[model samples]
Target: MKARNRTIQLVILAVIALIGLFTIVSNLSAGPAKYPQVGDKAPDFALAGLDGATHKLSELKGKTVILNFWGTYCEPCKREMPALQRQYDKWKAQGVEYVGSNIGENAITVRGFLDQYKLTLPVWLDQDQAVRKQYGVSEYPTTFFIAPDGRIAKKQVGEMNDAFIESALAELVKK
Candidate 1:
């Protein structure tokens, strides 16, 4: 009787181990999620701005769009804002849309940062960071240069300078 009980316990443990192994195998087989790369279609998202305006990526299809994912706490993101502003100023007249997507921040905080920087570029708040994750923004300042046709021309993963921004814009518009 004791031997039979031990045998049953061993069988139950083996069943649980098999289930765990199956789950692990299934997850491993699923592989990693794919992020948007250069030449891929930019993932579209509709997020609200500080002014209470909803900006949709698909709606800006006809214009070259610069999607900048940033956070107020990141020094590199702050450092690149002026360069972005300069580029925006240079290209705004030509219908270039620079969308600054603030990741996981409140309106007051973002508004204060913008005011402090004196940046007038259109700012969108990703309060839940859904848009940031959709864009696969692992870093603080990841900039995606989307061409007029809605294709990603370049993915700048760090702080950008005026020259790099200009070159990216030039390449984006060339499409």
Candidate 2:
């Protein structure tokens, strides 16, 4: 009986080790990490907008893109929406594109929030959080400022104030 119990314990340990090894190998073979650093070219992703239009990061090559990841339920995201909208409105004529990505939410939910706030910032759906995971967003309101050349100029986690938003845009548009 003692030998049998020892064998069972060994078998369990071996199974756990195999699982860990498999996980490590799987991550290694999954290609480069999608978490892009500052000055690195932002990873390209395509998401559907409310109007059923596809918005792709790579397609906005010559325009400074503000890629914001947010959820409707987040209060900070709600508070900063106006500031983001203002900057987007103020700088869009100068070739600044704002891609408001709603993480893990359906269109109806996002539409309701948009209607409640009367927001005009073109929001895209990140259903299943594929884009969220790709961008390595662990916070509710993470913003990525992509330069006109497609390189990430800055990445901001947490809520941003109006001045910070303006400053980032000022730099992005000037480049």
lDDT of 1 by residue, 1-175 (tens): 9999999999999999999999999999789877889999998899998899898989999899999999999999999999999999998887799999999898999989889989898899998999888878898899999889899988888999999999888876665
TM-score of each: 0.81, 0.80
RMSD of 1: 7.9
What is the number of residue pairs that collide in model 2? 0
Q: Count the backbone clashes (under 3 Å) in each candidate.
A: 0, 0
- The lDDT, on a scale of 0 to 1, for candidate 1 is 0.90
Candidates' lDDT values, in order?
Answer: 0.90, 0.91
Predicted structure 2, TM vs. truth: 0.80
Give the distance in Å from residue 113's predicted Cα in candidate 1 to where it truly belongs.
0.9
- Could you tell me how far off, in angstroms, the CA of residue 80 lies in candidate 1 after the best superposition? 0.6
Per-residue lDDT of model 2, residues 48-144, tens digit only: 9988999888998999999999999999999999999888888889999999999988899999999999988889999889989988899989999
lDDT of 2: 0.91
Q: Candidate 1: misplaced stretches above 4 Å?
A: 1-31
